[model samples]
Target chain A: MSPKGPAPSSVVREFIKDIVVDNRFCFSFPAETSALNKSVASFGVINPVWIVKSQDNRKTIVSGFRRYNAARKAGLETIPALTFKAGREYDLFIAHVAENTAVRKLNVGEISRVIFCANEHFGHGFEKISDRLFDALGLERSRKIYDMLLAVAGYGPAAKDIVSAGMSLKAAYRLARFEPDQRETLCKWIMDNRYGTSKSSLMIDMIDDIQAVKKKSVDEIIADAEAHVSPDMEKPQRSSRLFESVATMRNPILARMRRDFQTALESLNLPPSVEVIPPNNFEGRHIEFVIRARDRSSAISSFKALSKVAEAESENTESSKLSGLFGWI
Target chain B: MSFPGFSKILIAEEAVSTPLTKKAKAAWPDIAPQIVRNLADHELQLDMEPDPVAAGKRTLALGPNRGKFIRKCPGTMGLVCCNYWVIDLVEGCPIDCSYCILQGYLTDRRIRLATNINDLVDEIDAELAGGTQPVRVGTGELSDSLILDPQLGLAETLIDIFRTRPRATLELKTKTANIDSLLNLEPADNIVIGWSVNTPAIISSDERGASNLHDRLAAARQIVKHGWKVAFHFDPLVLHDRWEEGYRRVVDDIFSVAPPEKVAWISLGAFRFHPSLKQVIRDRFPMSDILNSEFVLCPDNKMRYVKPERLKLFRTLKNAIVAKAPSTPLYLCMEGIEIWESVFGGSPRGDKNLCQVFG
Candidate 1:
């Protein structure tokens, strides 16, 4: 069967106070009104609010909560509104949700609120409500993605904004589990520095793992990172160094072994064409040496240079330093 | 038994007459068996529950095997195989270790009793009838062999089949000390009672429902005295603080009671798992620190400690085991040939007996 649209309503002017303003069904983030106050004061309620009659024939406001709230602050006596016939409260809630979903450029906070309240207002199963809202948002059907989005409706203001600005779920999952103060500090720092998703994600992952391992607070970790980074360094370089520090903090032994390997590799100072590469995390037994020679003769020359190094006294060689990598557990 | 049995028993209408069903009904008398027309429909409801794995552990279903009962073990891809065969006697184990792969693999969490053990025995009897080489068949691959043996007496039937076959060895691996029925039975060969052992910390932390280290070793000692061969599996060697001392103590305790001649084999496997199981473990065991360690994707697509750390852990434990008992045969489970060589000083193929099963 084809789906039916909401019932029709007529526009009329009603006293802002007389219209029993019950907004439990409204789909929105926690109400903040600076922007709405400025817009309503300038535009003078360009569009009418939507309302319906309650059980006892009292009019109830359905949508345009921000506009009505702003009008109250602006000291308006009567507000223009669309009055639907009685007993269409649920229908009006869904229609307003659809209109908001289709028309508004919603932030993640707004999107999450819409999804959360739509399920609540309609009393539908979370799965069904989430499916409709995810379709409205044009998101992929990932497991628990809808649930996580719904959970965002409860986050602090800064965290919601960070998610709105495009932090990946991969990063947000870690950030969600952090203590509220830690989450807010990281979110506030991300907002203040205007770190994009990739940088924000790396910050969450590295810092979370480091603090878990070192038993350090986020404040101390951040302070340590900033103090160690030179003041004159650029923001990107600072971030890079901060990440390295946390990486080292999470795996101290591996980090030290990696430094020793690099130093030993540098001491050899092989021919230009020959480059030594350590296995990822020094986990494997083999150390790869790539020869990027320009021609056959250069390749032969690079091989001869390596042979010369091998011919040197075994004590002078750095092969023993390579063994140090395996010693770390 | 240290573990609580099933909360509810689900029996297929046709399978209600099976001896295993009657045994489960008798064991948990408070939980009356509900005749189910379609077990799959009931299992799907488990997916909708908040915790399907936990729900499956509490529910027991007795039914016929929809397919053959015996199959080759699906060893990790790109890793060495032990050529182990498995019997799906029970589809799930009650000993719910936090890192058990069954949590992710068994979508239907119900402890499905393969009620048609008669058919399973007959099928195994045919498979082992003609083989000259010893075929290592085990019921513990998918489910513990003795978790229900106190009530079901399932091991005796399998022992009857394996004891008569000269070329077959049956392993009843478990984390529980439920070996009462096995002790009274006639002494038999080609039957190894294996226990999956871990340190005290791991046992208390992760393996909440299984037997403790002392109890498991005591059970092994009991079986050893009965003239039955015993095996020890230190599989999934989880890395933890002071793990070296913990594992060394376990090895010392095992040798102090279990003679090396009674040992069928000792296999060492480092903790490794599919990446997807990480979240399951985290959610089920919120306080567990296992997932906090540094892991990398190995060639088999399973997340494991980096190769160097694995080598270090294996070498440390190998030295401890050798110091206590050098003559006992040792092999690496689901590891590369290089790891086998590094841990045992040679590949599985290098030893004549190891070549039969682990080559």
Candidate 2:
């Protein structure tokens, strides 16, 4: 129940160098041992690091990675430890999960490792993963989510850094579908540019569409998409521009229809208060106009303006122009 | 093997003495049938197979129909109903489509056949016993009607049953071309042979183990010549580059072989699936590009094309089909009034020709 993990018999000081950073059972983010280093330098290890005797008689650190790292950094000759005889690979790995999940929240990268290890332990899939495992990690019990975690767990180092650096798990999952180098390029595009979760997701969907339609590698698609974006634009505008570029590449015809419709509407140049709402997917037969009027006279003026646009008889009239929108649908 | 290409014969103990099991044993004298007392408890430990679903697919199981085999199609909520009926003659399809709903929800994943044809026929008779109205019953909802029909001669047996009841129309829908059994039999107006169709591009990319577009059309041509009323289902009209051209060509191909008059009906449905099937397609068929589309969740809680795109796709295909054959009793499957009106200018509920079946 304690953050330090369940107490085992016979805590003793073991040489810091003797504790190997056993990645086989590790579930921690990159070391953040600065404060711990200063603390250990002053106070020494207040808690014992958990280790198991490896098959070859070497001591493997199962938990307390941060404390171990800090002790090594603080130039300690030895640190207090709890030792156990290794029973099973999965059991030892689960002990690592329990120790860290008890003390702090695991980042997406660390959680990926947990899920990856669990899936390996299961020897098939995590389809039968326990609700307790998900609950213990403060996650929604979903195969889809766990599948994403398992995928990210196998991701290249660059993606791991991005996941650890705080990319939303959903965005990372989408990006993970691509090949490693392609994923690295997209990771740079997303993380280096600091695209938020929503933007990152939209951008990835657009890229996915382009890749699917063109049947090109994702790297080529990203390269082509990024070429259309401007370096001079501000961040949000740049993001919007990149999205539009990729979206256009995804569906050029649909995108052109929408753009042409926007131009035609702008040509009407209705008052700022009068807004024309395009049909939803141009589905069904409906177009709408909104007139936010302060007075009845302004409302009348807005209607009169709509009437001019709607009631024109000439083939070249604005009404006829609006008819083109219907044709697109 | 009753069903060829199956690696294992999992038999329900209840089906041990059934005609189907006898046919299976007589066909394959070598493989032993694993008789399961409760199929629910029977599990396939196919861990070594990289894809358990694909491996499970290669396993066949014959079982008693646990529930009613004949039922009205549970069409999604808010979708137009054609009043079509379905008989679960088989429990799973051998032809794998990336968008198949089976990938998401079929609990018993192996290809399972209903061993009690007599009970199945009895259930069908009870449904159509008193009905003077023509009823359209099909055998492709849960499984392709003809995937295993070649080995079992399921078509000949079911057609024999329906031929006696002139009012009960039986349709066997499939993606396979194994119609040799049905060819020599007397063709009845009540018995229609339907085929799920798509563009050749789609067939090559997504439909694994199914007949190619050309072969399917050829099979349809032969069936029509044999005097059976044939139907076509462009159920998953997928959107891709040059999709219009692809669909137009297939439409031309359809009219060329199966003439408009001989065709009983043609149904158009966009590629729709449960959202979770996306992962299955990605895992099983990574080369599949069908998931790369703009999809929106609909009222039925299935992912379909966006309304505008859907309307556009339907209108384009409808126009092409109408140009070739204006009176083919065209209808939209699992679609609601809004789309029907948007594309056809009225709902199927109002069309007199379609109303006879759906009214």
Candidate 3:
């Protein structure tokens, strides 16, 4: 539709006609269109239809495969669209993105494509591209771009299936922080039923370890990563059932220090978390201490005493390392 | 807008009207109520509180410099005002921006609405009264310049104050539609009215309680229509989803409202936060995805985008801004020397400042 043409109102809906996907401006489905159609039927089209005017003047769908399929499934001949004057395929792709992602939802892949194409097309960084898009969209959509980037990094590609395909902004941001290779791997892993969202963070941590130690050998990186994995994130190796019978004595060093702090409190018997240890590990960070008490006054008193002890310990520990270590001992 | 979490207040018994003040009242009335309420809310203990200004202070000092001290703004070669001079004004803003550093740095969480305008003027007058070189200054370093315009009429008074001294110019940076206090003022080539802007998301999530981006652009248009030199800022440019579209919209919107020739200058700053304030901001804006960007520590220990990332953002923003405001002076805030060299291709200077381009 040309800018000079009349805008689509409720009445214009009747005049709107169905168009095919064989136009010069159209692109193919990245995945299964039928499945996408099913998803859209069950969920809904998250992003709008990207269309371009065919030589014959029919508005042809350029993007939004799911939307097109859903429309087909619904036996609809036409869909809502604002046609673009297409030139460069990349530019058209970006325009398609700006049209929908501005106010609607997009997957990390779609967002990354636009950002990547923006740099490739306009020759700029994600920040400038983001700002430029922000200014163009009037700021609201620009904020979504920031969130999308975080999603891609945090969730990786599996996020595309679990989050982006469904258009969950929160999940996208959580996935964006992971390395691209890891994202793809985890995505496949999730697809193959090896892991789920519950194990997502653990997978991401393993990826982070690999990335951190990339300069070392792959074996070294994996070993280091394996050593650091909390028992929760990694499956413990079973020694033919011999290791299962050994009486386990698990003692958190920090918990021991915390117990000492509680003993010092005496009648102050504070909550397990409130007793502050010396600032050996958690220095310069505000800690959340829950002081469960019989009453508010005792809680208050325990808080005061804990604060005093923490403050004194922090100072003493800073001045003398030996005392700091010994204090904990 | 009501300044939430405000505990301390200072009342200004004196009613002063300058052109800038009148303009501000006409621009944003929401700000006036908060400013006026703050003045009435606090106890007037004395004629003046101690100026807690300190020499060689860090960048994260909250408002209320305990002592009156003079320090140069570490502004680079070509920018207008020194950033440090403005830091001495007030801390804590009532306006919320998801990207605002105050979200992280300001512990008090209340608007430290500074009422010691007289003392500030006196100190500025004494310092720059006979200084040999021209001194560039602004009030937006700590708080929104016109947030208190209705009650204090600060811009008008400051414009009038600066009229006597041609060497110094006061730039009031804001994201509000507060131009009334500035419209009627005798247009001073020296006094620059700047508006901080970003993608719509920046305004919505980062700049909560502030005017929408369109309103700000409209306000800038009003200023230019009234024959005042204007400026725009994309400071704390956040990396967000569809950021390209967002920034493009901002640039196009600005051009539609005010011609490039009407602009004095434009600034581009990538999102940078103090280490201490990151958690605060995260807690305050739990849904904000800004904290998840690829960040590296600067020499100041503040978290900023990597140099490559900064350069990339700078280049993209600069190219688009220059398309319309080609001749308008552009600079970066709190960026390093290498970035300046890489992005703009040359160092910026005072003669190269916005005043030189549009003054």
Candidate 4:
């Protein structure tokens, strides 16, 4: 292909079967096609997909793979596409990535694909291309991010899907450090439970602690009855319970402290209007007393009641016990 | 130090024509200096890179120490703080330790070498004159005191200032063997030169660009030969396989080089960092096994080894040091009173006792 103007007006109508969906260009976990199909059916593809002709006289969709799939599903016989002269492979990859990124923010899986595809086409000198590629793709220009995205791309398609769903880039990078089967099981569990980004991160830490400290296999840890998901609970409830159980098992001392705090609070047996709140993680010296009093008189009465309760509790409880409850130990 | 050293030197315009800036320019005569309007301009130039670590390595910024140069060490709340005073002459360190808290503590990576040494000296003199109680003052809290000492010669100036003061001691702490500038100076009873030492394995693996364990001990030996009190900090002590043997070797190396009475104090602190430093470590040093160990978030919001693990490491190391030099005072840095009591059978409780140990 000879050099031409930068922006070529080469829109053409091509048969649906003639356009190929390159796996490199398509998102691993695409959005639902029905909505796009409905839109294309009603509005008739407003924007033409970008494409490049191959040596075999076939066209490859550089961008808009989702739109092509949606158009095909909508029973359209043909679609509009703007073909660019196939220049250097690097340029083609950049154009494809730029078009897709311009359309919407790329997810973790798509970002991984772009990085790997760029590397394959550009032939390894990441130091030269990382800054430019990151800038063009609207990614943080960091070697750390580049390395992580590459590792995330190394995962199988299923794991990539899980990452695209909601798992954070950091969590995916951490999971990539594990063995393939372990990584898959962990990712699948996270996906099945619909764990949000933060929960997924916590889950990863829990698994890491279990493997490192307890010397248990990821499979064994997940298969334990303590981690078993209750059938009657909703997804959020199941995830919350599983997270709590994992945290409790991971830090038994902390769990014991929390349990002791609860026991201490219950032993006080304060009225509902007067509540005692322990510090976060029971790691502070002060316990807050929150009293819901209606007026000044009520406030005075609540304070008097609190004083009485404190005196009685002090008389009953040893200083060491109270100090331990307050994290003085 | 791995990267190219300081491609461009940026001097604050406000600091132009000052003696410190002139000294900085003279220190590196080969590299022409560029005078920016202010430190803000220098920072703006640094912000151009998306990731500034590399750029920061190649750029050097010299500015006045606008903030209070002499301030209390912001020790973690609820922990037994040893009321140490800090003299921050620099903002960042050149030697990169994988587990360094400065990686997260500093906002930028540029080596902000403060050229306003006169103001720092004035502040310290004022602080010492105001109080009769002896105070332990150090310059290694923000950056290593001697990494750039060959160029700036701040150590000599600081030593000269502290030698005359009766109520304060100047502690020059470092991980490098950059003590050539201070070897020939007059020995001050109040001046203590401290070295941050770790196991040989950790020195090779994590402490990039720092002097190795052998060289640091040799440097301490040189300082002690001059009748200057020396201290050692086994800070951020990492636990690895055969760690006991590794740490035992370090303790033995310390006693072999420096005499027991000449040693001022030995401080032990296990690896601890803010929670955010965990990700930074993983990103920067992927192969480091430091984070793989068990860590719990303490009340101060820093991640540390759990109580039992910390107690075990401290007690073992303490016993080793005591066996070698029973008279040398040992203290724990930034540790809770409970751990202190567990390890030492009592707590320092306040700064007065801690200062008295050194006194």
Could you say which candidate leads in lDDT? 2
Best by TM-score: 1
lDDT of 4 by residue, A1-329 (tens): 86533454478888888887666555435645677778998877778887777677777776777778778878888889888656545666666676667767778887887788777646654665575578777766566677778888889755777777666687667777578888888878877877777778788877876776677888887777244567688778877887787777677666776787777666666667887776555444468879998999888888887788778767877653344445524
lDDT of each: 0.77, 0.78, 0.56, 0.77
Query: In model 1 chain A, which range of ten residues has the least summed lDDT?
Result: A320-329
Error of 4 at A139 (Å): 2.5
Across A1-329, the per-residue lDDT of candidate 3 in tens digits comes to: 46532232221221124655633323231444677677766665544565655567675566665576676686665555655554445456545556665666545455544554456555666466665554443333333455454345344435556543443344445445455665565555444433445444334333432343233332344344334444343333421111111101011233454455445545334456464344333222233345667888877877786776667667776553224333332
lDDT of 2 at B56: 66
Q: Every model's DockQ, to 2 decimals?
A: 0.21, 0.20, 0.01, 0.18
- Pairs in steric clash, model 1: B56-B109
Please give each candidate's TM-score: 0.82, 0.81, 0.46, 0.78
What would you estimate as the lDDT of candidate 4? 0.77
Per-residue CA lDDT of model 1 for A189-212, tens digit only, reads 766666677877767766776666
Angstrom error of the Cα, residue B29, model 3: value is 15
Considering every candidate listed, which one attains the maximal DockQ? Answer: 1
